[model samples]
Target: MLILKKLSMAMYMDQEDINIKFEKMGKIRTALVGYGSVGEKMHAPLITVCPDLELVAVVERRQEKSKEKYPEVSIFRSLEALLEADAADLIVIVTPNEFHFSQAKMALEAGKHVVVDKPVTIHSREAKELKQIAEEKGLVLSVFQNRRWDGDIRTIQKILAEGLLGRVVHFESHFDRFRPGLADNWREQDVPGNGITYDLGTHLIDQAVMLFGRPDWVYAEIFKQRTGAVADDFFDITLMFGSIKARLTASVLSKAPMPKFLVLGEKGSYIKYGLDVQEKAFKAGELPEGANWGLEDAQAWGELHLEHTSMTYETERGDYRIFYKNIADAISQKHTLRVPIDQAITVLEIIEAAFLSHQEGKRIPFKK
Candidate 1:
């Protein structure tokens, strides 16, 4: 597959073989619902990599910024305007958490394929509503659970898949930083779905679900770890999956951040540090198809332990753009979307349940 050339999974690539796979899929027309950090820094750059996808219009209130950054692209001041313009076949919602449900609902209702950023929606009810609406519309409704594209985590997943870690017993995933000072950003403001729990915690929790499916119960402590923080900043979410337990954590007070992922199984363990380079690459204006896109830096390789042997394993470079590419392919070629709305709803359920658990000071039962 063309993905093989760009993404290596225990195989060496020969150019002729790669091109044959690339010819099978066609390109798609895409629209951006928000022109914020995610739209400009991450999504825009990655869109360039997929030969089958075009970045048609960007929805934003600030026309000047949109015009300045994407001069050749159509700029709409609102979702209403964008939909009226009928600029593209797909709408990607990178808007704030509170707007996700309504915006995604409108896009799907309008017969446009939709992809919302993480957290899916403020609540599971909203997610379920969107899922039903999208199903009725026969449109692809997906969430951008982008961290699964992280190189370290993907490598960890590969290890687990290969039985290198045997049967995983304990897994820890963290997204922490020392952002003691709050930003004027909407994420720090008092808003539903605007907190570390929905922001960083969603990625970790969604990943846990992706690897292990939904848990039977969840125990979480969601609180504001930073002084004067309006929203939650610290959370220790525990997922109980019968025989195994997974801990997904995030903190604003962490000065020295810990490993990105730590997985322990019956046979061995895997420890990884540092976030993937794809985000940095996207921010630095590298295309998703850039040379050596997800290739890991030697210095940032992870460590693996098996039996009495300890070895350093270079993390597979994560390509967040893959999520968009897959979504585009799914839209055009009838391939199954990577992060479906149902999966997104499950993520929201976990998040809401975690919050309820924290509020009630008890474990929350998982509800299908």
Candidate 2:
């Protein structure tokens, strides 16, 4: 057992050596379980160019359709088959909400690194179990909370770092959209982790927790705004950290949406509109890199309101590639991951508390 462990550790070369080896290797072996919207649009294309990662085989039930879409890459029908084939070093789960835990558990148990699309799991307990499993198995477990790398969010983080908004007292985040007529996908179904709070809310919540540490108390109200929707369509979340407060909201039925971000402090306030364009560009098959990748349209620039005067600040460019780059660095070089496991666990805890608070009609205290 010790010899096998040493061999695995040895295979994980230093970051620089890994980069050199990757250049020589040409591709890092990888597989996608679900070829749905996220997998086909985001992960697959990004992996195609990532120097340290490669697309080997995909796991799908329909062999013919998987082959039709990706003729060069082999297709396995199940996780068991994929594991036995020695096809990949890493497995990415973009499956339905309820399947994330099981799929990730299977991957880690099989001695392969794993990555799951956001919300980590339906409940905090599930996330905790997965964390324990990953630790015991000595594997890399990561969540695809891509919004952390959003260009505008990064810019806001930089502003905060620079103390532009002196002594932040209140902040707001919105992810409004026009999806009233719910899609036919599983996201719209009534299931564990199938609401806006779990869907888009995860991004806002994760960003809030990322910017500010875990809150002492979380006050949230979730409801369905769409006429006939089974799951929630709107959420108003407030995270309290002593005297400061972070407000987050998202609704699918809004027509005239407001700024994506609003931050206020003793010195000044900053307001930003328009989502990042990287996803749109990514979907359109464009990866020029270091160009205008994350640039916000000038007309949609944010406004900065000083207590004494008002000024408009052009939104900084946004980038999503950094997430993958950092993951590769952590895996190959043993560097600290951009978003550590503890933070992911915190996000889940907040989510669990929010659900409990909503059910009992009161603010829930976060346990240390």
Candidate 3:
């Protein structure tokens, strides 16, 4: 047993060689799972652009699709085969929400670091189990809460840091869209983790939790607004913390322009509209190289209103690639995980609470 422990420690130390000497370090070989829209457009490009990471392999069930863009990468039909081949040091699971738990468990048990797309798992308990496995194996585990680096959120962080928003009191965030009809997508299907509450709600909830810790309680009203919709299309969740309240809402029927973020504080308010530019660039298949990759146009800037005057506050450049860089650093033992599994689990807990709140028609106290 001691011999096996020694071998595991030695292997870990060898992989995290930067901890001993930066000159001997090598790029972390990363494997991507599910070459779907997000995997192809966002994860692959971000991984390729990071200096400390390499896109080495991908798991695709059907045709060799990833080869068109990443020809150098090895393609496997199943994650079991990839693990058998010992192809990569890191596994990125960008598969659908239901597959996240099983795939992440397999990778972690195989002693590979993992990054799961947001919401982590279908249930918070499943996420807790994955966290235990990763901790027992001394592996790096994180969720892809990439929106934490969105331009507007980054700008809000800066504003708070500079005391420009003086003790924020209310934060209202909206993620409305015009898709009144359901697309034939898995997210809108009758699945274990389907609905806007788990889709956009994950991002919105994570952002609120990241900014204001856990809420004291959750009160939500969730519904399937569109006809013939199996999954929920609308939600208005409110998280209360002492004198502050964070309201997060989303719907598929909203057509008119709505405020992306409306923040009120003791001093004044900050109102912002328009989504971050990185997702648009990524969906358009733009490579994440060069300095200007995430810069928001001045026209999309938000407004900060004080008692006497209101001014345009420049939106900070949003960089999704930073998430990959942080992952690399965390693997090298140079930095702590930015979106730790614990945060993701907390997001899941809040989600569960919100659902319960809706079902019971009462404000539910958030479980720690």
Candidate 4:
């Protein structure tokens, strides 16, 4: 009788272990808010490809557009409906710049982990409050600074880490495009946090901050160059780090070709042209899997001009899908968040300072 009782207990323990393992491997139900370009093109597809995540629902205000591509995914009329129905374990906010803060706050308060698109929020204080809420609730909060995974950016990071740049004296990054006419969109309109600075500026600034920590002072000139442009269409911002200068600029009227990145160091210089291949692929409706997904062609490689010789340096593979994968791991496997809320707050602080610098026509001292 004693032997039989011990056997029963061992079997029960084994069953419990199996159950725990299965729970850990279960998929996180993800709901995407806003089915705009970012949602429909990037986030939705990436979420679907992540093995540990299931694209369960989406919040579409007007039309049921998501149904065409994601027929199985339920469509919520609004964020409130999705929250009330408890339709998702993770909520991804890909809405306009204005809605990021309020939507993220609502999701966190409703006990759902949140992933907000770039800029996190319009203000640093709002981002901090969201961070506090997530911490108090013991939930994961992240911003989709996807450009950090860009091939060119990653290559720059690798070069910096390998000490190829020696003591970097200057870093210049650009996101210029030739759009002489303004589009009838929220980003071009007179809306809060609506401008090229908030759109492209966020990515460049985030990349700079990731490569080098905070800057000492910021000087900027933000203006509108396009015809009938109410929002800012051009920005040339400089981040001063002691002797090192980082200049980030973007303009819609830039018709001439400009190097995407230019880094000058004591030893040599690295100049790269062309944006990451992942954005074009995503826009082309390509899935984020397969071996050749993020690979950059050798023809598009950057040039490393040294004192005597210049060579083409291959760019690192750009993998934006890793962002979603990291989110899944953070939620299910207890991995640390790659793009934490605090980092997003820091980016917003820099942005605020840049605007101040442009407004007051003086270099603003950096402050936490």
- Using TM-score as the measure, the top candidate is 3
The regions of model 2 sitting more than 4 angstroms off are 1-26, 63-70, 288-290
lDDT by residue for model 2 over 125-230, one digit each (tens)? 8788888888897677888888887877887888899998899999899999887797887778887779888888889989988988889998889888788899
Alpha carbon lDDT of each predicted model: 0.83, 0.82, 0.93, 0.92
Separately for all candidates shown, the number of backbone clashes (residues 3 or more apart, or on different chains) is 3, 3, 0, 0
Q: Arrange candidates by TM-score, highest first: which order? A: 3, 4, 2, 1
Per-candidate TM-scores read: 0.90, 0.91, 0.95, 0.93
Error of 2 at 256 (Å): 1.5
Point out the higher-scoring one by TM-score: 2 or 3: 3
In candidate 1, which residue pairs clash? 27-52, 28-52, 294-317
Q: Give the lDDT of residue 200 in candidate 3.
A: 98
Q: Candidates 2 and 3: which is better by lDDT? A: 3
Residue lDDT tens for model 4, 1-368: 99999999766776457557638658989999999998999999999999889999999998999999989999999999999999999999999999999999999999999999999899999999999999998799999999999999999999989989789999999999999877978999889999999999999999988988889989999998877889999999999877889999999888899999999999899999999999999999998999998999999999998888999999999999899999988876457999988788888999999999999999999944
What is the number of residue pairs that collide in model 2? 3
Q: Model 1 over residues 196-290: C-alpha lDDT tens digits?
A: 88889888988888888989999999898677888888999999887788999988888895988899999998998887887777777666775
